[model samples]
Target: MADTKTLAEIEQRIAILRDNLRELVEQAAGFSGAANEELTADRINEQQAELDELLKKRDAMTKS
Candidate 1:
């Protein structure tokens, strides 16, 4: 079970992750190399996974 403080912290992290993904996509759009695109895609995937996990955790916490 998570306390209110923990839930708030999770929410904050989720927001930050979303901002990071948006910025990464914008930067990727400007880059022209295949290697840069691949690297950016990998980073986006990792961040997306993290955001998904946090979203799940937040849902579970709220349901409890």
Candidate 2:
């Protein structure tokens, strides 16, 4: 079973990831060029994957 501290840490990480994802989305939306747009899109995808993983981990911890 996970301790309270561990759960809190996971929740904090999730919050950070959510913030990062928001920032990435905003940046992607603000872009008007072509060269850097691909890079920004890739980064958004990566952040989304990371956020999804963290959410899964948090769910698992809570279920235990």
Candidate 3:
């Protein structure tokens, strides 16, 4: 049988993925030109919030 992961484990993986996405977003920022001046903290925060919600859901699943 395949190895099983508890809910906590899943949440940790989701958090790691979020961090990777954040790093990618930061790297992409350097390439943003005048055409894309709308990149702001709010956008990144929104992404973070989305990731947080996903992690929360993963955590909740483990409670079942």
Whole-model Cα lDDT per candidate?
A: 0.97, 0.85, 0.65
* TM-scores of all candidate predictions against the true structure: 0.95, 0.85, 0.46
TM-score of 3: 0.46
Residues 1-64, model 2: lDDT tens digits: 8688988987898888889888888888889788779888888888789889878888888889
- 20-51 per-residue lDDT for model 1 (tens digits): 99999999999999999999999999999999
**Candidate 2: which stretches are off by over 4 Å?**
none
TM-score between model 1 and native:
0.95
Quote model 2's TM-score.
0.85
Highest lDDT among the candidates is held by which one? 1
Most TM-score-accurate candidate? 1
The lDDT, on a scale of 0 to 1, for candidate 3 is: 0.65
List, residue by residue over 1-64, the lDDT tens digit for candidate 3. 2124665566677777688677757766775665443554456666777788877776567555
The Cα RMSD in angstroms, rounded to one decimal, for candidate 1 relative to the true structure is 1.1
Q: Higher-TM-score candidate among 2 and 3?
A: 2
